[model samples]
Target chain A: MWFDILPSFWEGAKITIQLTLFSAVIAFFLAFLAGFGRLSKIKAVRFLAATYVEIFRGTSLFVQLFWIYFALPLFGIMLPKMLAGVLALSLNAGAYGSEIVRSTIISVPKGQTEAAIALNMTPWQRTWLVILPQALVMMLPAFGNLIIEMLKGTALVSLVTLADLTFVATVLNSSIMRPTEIFSVLLVIYFVISLPFTRGIRWIEHRLSAGRY
Target chain B: MSVPLKVIYNEESTKSIGNDLRKVAVQPIVNYSNISKSYGDLQVLRNIDLDIAPGEKVALIGPSGSGKTTLARLLMTLEEPTSGTIEVDGEMLWHQKTNGKLVKANEKHLHKVRGNIGMVFQHFNLFPHMTILRNVMEAPRNVLGLSKEEAMERAVTMLKQVGLANKIDAYPAQLSGGQKQRVAIARALVMRPKVMIFDEPTSALDPELVGEVLEVIKAIAAEGEMAMLLITHEMDFARDVADRILFFDQGRIIEQGSPKRIFNNPESERLQTFLSRFNRH
Candidate 1:
């Protein structure tokens, strides 16, 4: 049964890998935009960014995915399963990631901003040249955990019938009637796949955190 | 026996004398007109009208919370005044003439005016992620639009002047308090600002480290061309470096005169009590 299921699982794994990678990239970009927006001096920009974070974070990723996949067609805007899954994960993960970006940026000392200002730097230049670099160092530890959570969040894509790893594992269980072996194998596979990501994040965190307390 | 006196009219000395004459001809470099600052009805500074001449070294000394630091911050534009205007090098800092009408200065105008002033903070405030050389070079290259080579050369010279030339590649965390303050001075000097403000530059240092930072400041004062405003508690150091001392009390300049006069013949009871406390410490 394991042998028979290997090819199907491999196909599902490929989609899952692509989905997680694309969603994480998109989510990372969104997090920065939203995070900076929240800190923007302009009230409207701050409010809009805050709204995005709250709307996504206040609700369930499961419901969000289901809405885009199942309900949005009623409005004559049908999205492909993969697109819906990726969109849901990106928005959800980006919301949480924005807080990580914001808090880290805020935690950088007020003295840094004052020093930059005294140097006659414009607000944009100060943020770019001084504040962001230091904040990025502080964000790495929190960002590592967020990335791992994003990876785990990709598992939900299976529910929308995207034939992700979990979807394949479920199919195999129903067909083979070997629930114990198939489910255990599925669990082992997820842990195996997620191990390198966790290790990679730790490596990155270590590298970025040099000379930073 | 008598020692022969040789008269040497070196070009550098002549040029320095010419510069001094030029500085004297210009009006005050910084002028504060009826400046008042208040936070939620608690007045920090009150109707402070002052003029700092070119090449002048004015030290602000008073007891804590008497608004000495607030005055320095106002000059640096770190804190805005609730009323009145400030001018640096004859240009209004928070106000600008537009269409022959005075209007509140915008960001662009502030940046232009701010280029003429530099501030050395008590905490040093060096960019922790940058190397010492980068911290010194950043404003020159970015704000002043100097070429990388030019900025680096200026940074090296200023660092050498501060006696931290060897630590250019070092991080701020790797430096002692004295060394960090030196780097900050170098950073400000690289901008070649016409007005320099030192906001208790020695207050944050370890007692042993204060002398080294003050020595660098004294050297800068000795070669005075820029106007300097120092808010400091180091009374003796102030006497040594300052030509003029303003004694502040409860947000007002109670007595201001030559450092000798202020130190010796303090008029106000508040300043007298403050100086006595300072002497006891």
Candidate 2:
């Protein structure tokens, strides 16, 4: 009986993995862009980045998913279901991820910036070379938590009819009427999927912090 | 015999006078004109007109809160003066000439002007994440645009100068406070700056460690090619290394002269009192 249901769970797991990976890539880039944008000297750029963070973080991810998948088509912005899922997951996660970036950058010692300046590095060189490398290490733990949150958050895509793990589990259980057996498997799959990400971040944090202590 | 002797005297006096006049005519490498800085209601520096000649080793000595460090900071472009202008190597540091009129300097102007200056902080602010060699190599490779090989060669030479060649692979945290400060000196020196500012470079070190850092500084000053602005509480080091010393008190240069005159004569009462404190120590 377990072997019979395994292939169906694998199919849903693939979709879930794809959503997490795609959303994570977009979220990572958005995190740094919006992160640096918030620190920009230009008032307009700072304001725009702050607005992006506030709007995304202030609203629930569920509403954002519903709005993009259901409401956006009302205004004629017809996105595919997959695109909508990725978009909502990344945008929501990116908003939270950006605060991690900004605060970590700020926490880098003021002396580092001054030292770079005294070396005659331009503002850009100082930020990228001196500031960001140190900040990147400090940002990893928080980002690990965020990626796991995003992984779990991928379960929400089931509401839009995408056959991710949770959607497949629900459909399978309704027919078999074996909620305990099926849902237990679903919980294990989710936990299993998120484990590697946590380990990966820790490995990176260890690598980057080599000799820093 | 008397007529020939008089002719020799005139020629010798004329040559000496010419030499003195030429020395006076040489342009100062750093000039601060009517500069003042205020932090809102609190004034840090008053109207200060000062000039540092090329290759001149000038030490600034004062009680804490007398604005000695602020003077070097202004030159390093780390802090801005509220009013007045600074010139580094004959170009304005705080303002630039545009169409024959002075305008507040843009980033390019500031970068170009400040390229001639470098500073070492009290904390020895080495990049803790990078190895000692990379800490020394970073600026020359990135800012000066030297090739990696060239930067590496320069960094190695500077580290050797500061007696840290063995510690090239060590991270900053692995080094002692004195060793860290030496790496900082090498880092600043690798830039080949025209002016190097030491903002109490040895103040943060342990008492025994201070000698090592000071010895490195003394050797650098001995080379006599780069001008140095030393903000120090070590009066003995200042008297030994500085050609001229400026005594600052309450945001003004109360007295400045040859180290001998300032240390021995100490004309001002404040300077006398300041020297007395150091004497007891």
Candidate 3:
């Protein structure tokens, strides 16, 4: 049973990993664009970004997943299940990730902006060279937590008929008729995947923060 | 050895330039023409008109909230004036003439005109992520468009002037209050600004640490050709370094003259009382 379960679990975990990685790339990109937009001096840009954050954060992730997976096909636009899963996860996580990015950037001292301006740096140059580097250091810890949340969110793709870890586990449970053994293995696999990622993020956080003090 | 010789050479040339500058009826390097600033109903500077001569060191001594710092910030373009114009080297700082009329200078115009000025804040405000050398090097490389090697050399020389060349690799957090202020001074000087403004540069430091920062400022003043505006509470230091002193009270200059006249024989009762209060410290 262990040998038979191993191959299925590996295949399931690989799909899970792929969905998580793809969604993560989208989430990270949207996070910065939306985060910086929230801080934009232009009123329209700020309003749009704020609206994006509020809408995604106010609604439920389950409904959001369903909308991308099921509701979009109502308009005659059908996305493949995996891409839909990635889009749902990415959009949901990105909303939360933007807030993390916003708060970390705001936490940087006002004096840093003043110093950059005093040096006659253009606004873009100031953001890129001075404020962003310092803000990035502060953002790393929160970003680690966001990544873990994103990994957990990948579990929901199973409901969308994706052959992710939980979906595979469900199939295994029904076939084997041993819920205890199958679910236990599923739980262990999630932890096993998360543990190395957690360690890697901590190491990066340590290295980035070391030079400041 | 070469650095010290170069410093001496710069000093001699600056002195000759200073003399030649005085012989000609030179325009004021910084002309504050009826500048006024207010935040809501709270006015910070009220119709302030003054001129800073080329190579002149002007010290502004005032009680807190009297607008000395605001005046310095306005010149740095950190704060915009409510009305009136601040001209740096005869170019309008906050306004640009468009077609035939004056319009508020756009960000592009302001950045270009603002190149000739530098300022030091009470809080050292060094970029914490950068090492001391990079803090000094940043503006020159980014704003002045210096190459990396040229910027590095200038930053090293500026740091040496402030006596912090050895600490170039150290970050701001690793430095003391005095050392951070020194780095801030070096950071500003590397731009070779025509007008340098110091807003209570030593105020954030411990009493023992203030002397080192003040010493660096004095050395900077000795190198002529640039106008210096210092907003300071250190009366003795101000008197020693300033060629002229303006005694500020309630957003206005109550009296201004040579440091001797302002310090030894204050004409206005407001300034007399202000001096007595400072004397207690």
TM-score of each: 0.93, 0.93, 0.93
Q: Write the per-residue lDDT of candidate 2 for residues B210-276, one digit (tens) a residue.
A: 9999999999998887889999999889988887788999999999877778887989899999899
User: Against the true two-chain complex, what DockQ does each candidate achieve?
Assistant: 0.63, 0.74, 0.64
Ranking by DockQ: 2, 3, 1
The segments of candidate 1 whose C-alpha lies over 4 angstroms from its true place after superposition are A1-7, A204-213, B1-26
Across A1-213, the per-residue lDDT of candidate 3 in tens digits comes to 555676788888999999889988999899998998998999999999999888889986788889988889999989998998888888888889899889988988888888888899998888899989988877777777777888888889899889999999998888888887788888888888888778978887788767664
A145, model 1: CA deviation in Å? Answer: 1.4
- Rank all candidate structures by their TM-score, best first, as comma-separated numbers: 2, 3, 1
Best by lDDT: 2
lDDT of 2 by residue, A157-191 (tens): 99998999999999998898888878888998898
Query: Where is model 3 more than 4 Å wrong at Cα?
Result: A1-4, A204-213, B1-25
Model 1 chain B poorest 10 in a row by lDDT: B1-10
Candidate 3: lDDT over CA atoms?
A: 0.86
lDDT per residue (tens digit) for residues B50-92 in model 1: 8776777889998889999899888777889999998887788
